[model samples]
Target: MIEAVKIKTERLILRQWQDADRDPWRAMNADPEVMRYFPAPLTADESDALMTRCRDGIAQHGAGFWALERMQDGQFLGFVGLNCIGHDIAVKGQWEIGWRLARHAWGQGYATEAATASMAHGFGPMALPRIIAYTASTNLASMAVMQRIGMTHAAAEDFDHPLLPEGHPLRRHVVWEKIA
Candidate 1:
C-alpha cells in the first residue's frame, strides 16, 4: 500500500478524513449555497458515503481529497486535494485539483492557499506532468480560485458535462490546466 499523505499550509492542514468530519461534511453538502454549483444538495447518507469514499481513496492511493482543517482551531473547514478525473470528461483519467469549503471559510483565501499547496504536492512528490481543474461556467468563484492558483483556461477543451442532461444550466463546464 502507498504511504498516507498529508499536506500542510500556513493556515490549513490537508489531511485524511476523520469520523469527526462527517457531521460538518454533511452540513456543508446540504448547504444550498455550498451545493449551488452542483445538481442538488446531498442527503445525510449521501454525505456520509462521499466522505467514506474520500477516506478510502486516500487509503488506496496515498493521496486524494483530504479534509481541510484550520491550524489555529482545528476546525473542519472542508476538503482540498488531488483526485483522478473519474468522469469521461475531456481530461478523463488525468489528475485534478479541487476544493470545497464551508460557507464560513469562503472569502478568506483558504481555498487558494490549500490549492496551491495541493498542486505543489501533485507536481513535486507525485511527479505528475500536469493537473486540471473544471467547474460550471457560471461558477465564477471556483473559476477565480483556479486562476488564482495559476491554472490557465483551456477554452478549446470545454465540454458539456456528460452527467448533466441537455440544456442543464450547469452542464457546460470550463476547463483549466497547469503544467509541471
Candidate 2:
C-alpha cells in the first residue's frame, strides 16, 4: 500500500489521492474551461491513467501531486503539489509545482494557498535547490499563481512545448523559476 503524506495549510490540506477523487477528477478533466490551456479535455481513460501516474509517483518519491482538499468540509478541490518535469521541455528534469482546482473552487485564492504549502515542502523537506513552472503563454491565471508563489518569469527560458505540434495555439509556453 502507498503511504499517504499530508500537508495542511490554514484553509487547505494537500493529501494523498483516494478512490473518491476519481469522479471529481474526471469531471474536472472534462470541463472545457478547466482544461482551456490545454489542447482539449481529457477522456475518462486518459484521466484515469494520469491519476495512476500520480499514485505511482507518490509511491516512489513520497511526494507528487497531493490531492487538494478543503479543511472545512473535506471537499476534494483537485490537486496541488510538486512533480518532476518529465517532459523534454525547457524545465525538463527539474521539480515543478502545479495545481488544478474544480470550477467551484476558483476565485477563492485556493490555488495560491495550496501552491505556497507545496513550495515550502519542496524547498524545505525535499531540499530542492530550485523549482520551475510553465504554462501556455495565454494562461494568465496560472501565471498569476506562479508569481504569487515567488516564481519569476524566465523570458529567455520560454520555448514551444515539445509535445505540441508546430501550429498549435498552446504550443508556445512561458517558463518561471524560483531558486531556494
Candidate 3:
C-alpha cells in the first residue's frame, strides 16, 4: 500500500480530507455554477458518498482527490489531485489529475497552483510515467487549467464519455496528457 501523503505549493496545501471539510465540500458540490459543466449538482448524500470513496482511495492507494486548503488562512478551498479512472474512457485505468474549486475560489489560480503540486508528486514520488486530464469539450476553464499545468491535447485522443448518455451535450470529452 502507498503511504498517505500531503503536497504543498506556494499558496495551497493538497492533503487528506478532514471532518470540517464536509460542509464546505457539500456546498461546493451542490452549487449549480460549480457543477455547470457536469450533469447536475450533487445532493448531500451524493457528496458524502463521494467523500467516502475519496477517503477509501487514499487509504488504498495513498492518494486521491486531495482536500485543497488555502495556506494563508487554512480555509477549505476544494480538491485537486490524482485519481484512477475506472471506466473505459480514453484514459481508462490511468491516473488522472482533476480539480474542483468553490465559486469564491475561482479566478484566483488556486486550481492551477494546487494541480501543479499534484502533478509534481505524481511524476516525482509516485513515479508515474504520465498523467491525463479530461473535461467536457465546452469547459474552457478546466481546459485552461490543464494547459497551464503543461498537459497537451490531441484531437485523436478525444472520446465520448461512457457515463454520459448519447445525445447529451456533455457526452463528448477532450483529453489532455502530460508525460514524465
Candidate 4:
C-alpha cells in the first residue's frame, strides 16, 4: 500500500502525514528560527495547502518529504526527506535531501540520523545516482548536519540559488552532494 513505505530511522518514524498533523506542522513552520532560511512563515491556510501538496506529491511520486516523528513517543518532529528542487550544474534534475526538526530537537543527532536514512533512500531504494544538500552559506548548523551525514562540499560546482533574488540570504548557498 502507499502508506506502507514510511521509512524508519534510528529514533524517528518518517511516516505519511495525517490530517491531524496540520496544527503542529503549521506551528513548526511558524517558528521564526525554523523558517529563517525561507522567506516567510506559512499562514494556517498555506500550511494546510503545503501538507496537501506533500501528500499529493508522494501519492503521485511514491516518495517525498515525510512527516517525521519520535519513534518512542510518537511526537511529531517536523520532516526529513527528499524533494525535487531548483536544479543546477554537475547534476540536473536532482532530488534534494533535507530536514527541519523542531528547536527542541536540536543538539541531538536526530537531524543527521534521519537525513542519513533519507540519503540511503535516495541512493538505495530510490535508486538515484546522486542527491544534494544545499543550504545558506552562513547556516553553520545546517552545514554541520550535511557534513555529519558524510556529504562533501562541492564548492567549485556550487551555484547561487536561482530561485532566490540577487543578494537574498538563501541565495548564497553552498552545496554538498553524494553520488553513487
Candidate 5:
C-alpha cells in the first residue's frame, strides 16, 4: 500500500483532509460560480459524501484528491490531486488529476502550483506511467490550468462523460495528458 502523503509547495499545502476542512469544502462545493462547470452545486449532504470519498480514497490508496490550504494564512483554498477513474469508460483505471477552488482563489496560480506538485507525486512516488485530466468543454479556465502545468490536449481522446446524460452541456469533455 502507498503511504499517506502530503505535498507542500511554496504557497500551498497539498495534504489529506481534516475535520476542519469539511465546512469550507462544503461551502466551496455549494458555490454556484465555483461549480459552474459542474452539473449543479452540491448540497451539504452531497458535499459531505464527496469529502468522505476523498478521505477514504486517501486511506485506502495512499493518495487522492487532497485538501489545498494556503500556507501563509492557513485558508482552505480547495483540492488538487490524483484520483483513479472508477467509471467504466475508455480511461477507466487511469489516474486523473483534478482540482476545484473557491472563486476567490481564481486567477492566483494556486491551482497550477498545487497541480504541479501533484503531478510530481504521481510520477515520483506513485510511479504512474501517465496522468490525465479532463473537464467540460466550456471550462476554459481549467483547460488553461492543465496547459500551464504542461499537460497537452489530446483532442482525439475526448469523450462524453458517461455520468452526464447525452445532450447535457457538460457531457462533452476535453482531455489533456502528461506522460511519465
Candidate 6:
C-alpha cells in the first residue's frame, strides 16, 4: 500500500478525500470560474465518478491527487497530486502532476505549497524520473504555476486537445516537463 500519507507545509495539509467532501468538491468542479478553462462544468454524476477515480488513485498508487485542506479549520480547499493521464506521442502511461482549487482557495500559495510537496513525493519517494503537466495555452495562471515550479516548456510537443474543438480557445495545450 502507499501508506496513509499526510504532507504538511507552512500552511496546507494534503490528504485523501472523504465521503463528506463530495458535495464541496462537486460544487467547486461546477463553478464557471473554476471550470472556465474546462470546456464544460462536470455534472453531479461526473463529480461522483471523479471522486471515485481520486479514491482509486490513492488506493492504487499510494498517492495521487489529494484533497487540499487548510489546517486551521479543515476546509476542503482543493486537490493536488500526480495522475497517469494515459499519454501522447511516444511517451506512454504518462504520470502528470496537476492541481485544482475552489475559487476561495485561489490567490494564496496553497496550490504551489501542495504541489511542491507532491512533486517531491513523486520524484523522491515514488522515484519517478520525470513528471509532466499540460494546460490550456490561455490559462496563464496555471501556466505561471508550472513555470514557478521550474518546469520548462516543450513547445514542439504542444498539441490540440483531442476532446476540444479544432480551434477552440483552449484547444492548444502546452506541455511542461520536470526531469530528474
TM-score of each: 0.97, 0.96, 0.95, 0.88, 0.95, 0.94
lDDT (tens digit, per residue) of candidate 1 on 108-176: 999999999999999998899999998999999999999999999999989898889998999999999
Please give the lDDT score at residue 142 for candidate 2.
98
Q: How much is the lDDT of residue 10 in candidate 3?
A: 89
Pairs that clash in candidate 6: none
Residue 139 CA displacement from its true place in model 2, Å = 0.3
Off by over 4 Å in 4: 1-4, 86-92
Q: What TM-score does candidate 6 get on C-alpha atoms? A: 0.94
In terms of TM-score, which candidate is strongest?
1
RMSD after CA superposition, every candidate: 0.9, 1.3, 1.2, 2.4, 1.2, 1.6
lDDT by residue for model 4 over 45-83, one digit each (tens)?
Answer: 988988987777677667788888999998888888888
Q: Which model is ahead, 5 or 6, in terms of TM-score?
A: 5
Give the distance in Å from residue 76's predicted Cα in candidate 1 to where it truly belongs: 0.1
Task: Answer with 1 or 6, whichever has the higher TM-score.
Answer: 1
Question: Which pairs of residues clash in candidate 4, taking residues 3 or more apart in a chain or in different chains?
Answer: none
Q: Each model's C-alpha lDDT?
A: 0.93, 0.91, 0.91, 0.81, 0.93, 0.86
After superposition, candidate 5 runs with Cα above 4 Å error: none
Q: Residues 60-161, candidate 5, lDDT per residue (tens digit)?
A: 889999999999999999999999988797788989999999889998999999999999999998899999999999999999999999999989999998
| Tens digits of lDDT, candidate 2, 5-79 | 689999999887889999999999999999999999999999999998888888878889988999999999999
Candidate 4 to truth, TM: 0.88
**Model 6 lDDT tens row, 78-153:** 7898888754533348888899999998998788888889899989988999998988888889988888888898
